[model samples]
Target: MKKLLLDLCSKLEGRGIHEIIDRLKLYYRYLITVLFYKPFIGEMGKKTVIYSPIRFTGLKFIYLGAKVTIFDGARIEVVDRYGNQRFSPCLKIGEGTSINQNCHITCAEEIVIGMNVLITANVTITDIIHPYDDINVPISRQPLITKKVYIGDETCIYQNAVILPGAKIGKHCIIGANSVVNIQVPDYSVVVGNPARIVRQYNQMLQSWEKIYQ
Candidate 1:
């Protein structure tokens, strides 16, 4: 019996039983978070998993679609009132979209992210901009200027990219790593650099991506 027990233990160790236990714990945590937040969220679709250690504000204004997964350390906020300003904000994250760790998304008016979008780690998507028109008042205390931000279907935003107010990213577009996008990006284009500009665009007639030289 002792030899049989030792053999079973050896097999379990080789199978990485510890790793399986850790994964089970993580899934349990995710289940608890979903059950707690589902009642408060404006709309929580089926199979939407929100990982633990997330920072959320105005949960009632945020809507998440089916199979949307938000990883750990994400800060998602919908500001209905800030610094003497009142807003009716709506933040909608579409089906199958996955937001990676440490992404910050804040909206004061409207921000819509379309289906199957992949936002990598450390991305910031915001629709409110702090106005510093008055030099006498600090920027933190100033009123926010908000515009609608839209990201179309199947777009991929890479790590550390910032999507600012009034930016519209079209379908199947790619926003490169560490890029800052504050303008409109047409469909099937790849944008890179600060104040992101389209570096490559798909030409339907040629059935290929053509490089655009600045």
Candidate 2:
């Protein structure tokens, strides 16, 4: 009887029960988003949806455009370091954008995401860098270095990408998975790798993407 019970426990742990719990969590998140969360955001537009288990700080500085959908586990924080309105419009998400699960976007100065942007899971977009200039003070306590990040219209950022301060991603750009973007990417360009580089660009004449050598 003890052996049967142990087997049952192992089987249950390896199967259906875990999946059921996960599904339940997802549904609950969706429900909370629909019923409670969306209304609290400033400048939240029509047909916008935010799945719950999401965290936000400084909602007044954050703006969401129409038809934006934010998936579960997103952290959209507009940090006012000294708890003041010194930084206004810290974050702006344009129309028809969709941000996938576990994405983190923390804006100190400004981070503008333009229309129809698609950001996949585990992406991090930040406009502030923690200062390490003062050795006397801890890095966490030191003043932040703020810069504006602009993600232009129709940009697509894949999973595990990091868009750092001063990143200017132009319209219709594609940022590859696991890439770290810190520079300007031109319109209709495709970038990939640790320090992202433009590997391809859209050729208007051919209406296709042409490879960029070196």
Candidate 3:
């Protein structure tokens, strides 16, 4: 009888030790991704969802419904009001979208991003607006901020582009690399050049973007 009891104790101890090791592996993986790599999201229109690669701290994460994809060494900040103010502040995205390496996405008011969007490396999307009317205050410190930014579905924004506030890119649009979107680009348009101009419109019949020669 005593021998039987001893055997059962040994088996229980082994199982308990194995469970601890498994839990440690999961924790280690989460830590590595949050520290070194970026995370992706599922879907939402309010806040951006970050599945992996979460930062250690200084992450507001207010707008979490949007499907946000983070690449390696990307920095994300979401800041909103505590009480019931004018705006709650959110960065929203639709389903089936992703972002590439080394990007920075920050918002204070509200940003709406549609589904099936592809963002390349070193892209910056911010909702904070800066005022140029005042010469006394620096551009960064001006209080006169603008509205939010919106990116439609099935849109492809290339590398090194900056999408500022109060600018809206419609659905099925392609934004060129190294471009600064200062104004609104209509739906189904191919935008290029600095302060991005609509070079062409997408033809639904061809399933490709057509050039505007005229």
Candidate 4:
């Protein structure tokens, strides 16, 4: 199959056949994805494209809005049960949100990502935290603490950023690469650092992003 594709590509080098082939492949993949996952997903809107090789758990607890694109190698897990505890978890991805490759979203309670949010590669968003308060029990066996996470509309979370439990990122915010956000982020702000802090904020009157002195 590889040899045949290579030979075909060589033969059709300059005839714009490559683009046609690519589109066909994409359409085929989309069809396959919908057929395989649609039955299990609780609510999946039209034209939501989920690429191949995704690790999904509790599909019935996940809701995807229209035109949401989840790239390859993404892991979306909704944990409904942990030991004897049970949760009614919901993971909602709003319309036009694009979650890039290798992104991991784990929700035990609720995680709501608003419309047009851009989550770049390798980002991790989770609403559950593992507690190690007990020395007698293993950390993994301990009860989990969960909080609701919210990423507002038009927010951009860059590569390798971690949105931890109870994070409330406001609309049009920019979460910088490699940042760890665990608290509330005001609207139209640029945050960056280990424990992410606002470095700039959009001045509506001036229509510009001004550096925050603090």
Candidate 1 local lDDT, residue 211: 99
Question: lDDT of each structure?
Answer: 0.91, 0.85, 0.68, 0.92
lDDT of 2 by residue, 70-127 (tens): 8879898888764333555468999999999999998989899999999999999999
TM-score of 2: 0.81
RMSD of 4: 5.2
| Deviation (Å) of 42 in candidate 1 | 0.2
Error of 1 at 87 (Å): 0.4
- Model 1 clash count equals 0
Give a tens-digit lDDT track for model 4, residues 161-199.
999999999999999999999989999999999988899
Preferred candidate (TM-score higher): 1 or 3: 1
Query: Higher TM-score: candidate 2 or 4?
Result: 4
* Backbone clashes, each candidate: 0, 0, 9, 0
Best by lDDT: 4
lDDT of 1: 0.91
lDDT of 3 at 125: 89
User: What TM-scores do the predictions have?
Assistant: 0.88, 0.81, 0.65, 0.91
Q: Tell me how candidate 2 scores on lDDT.
A: 0.85
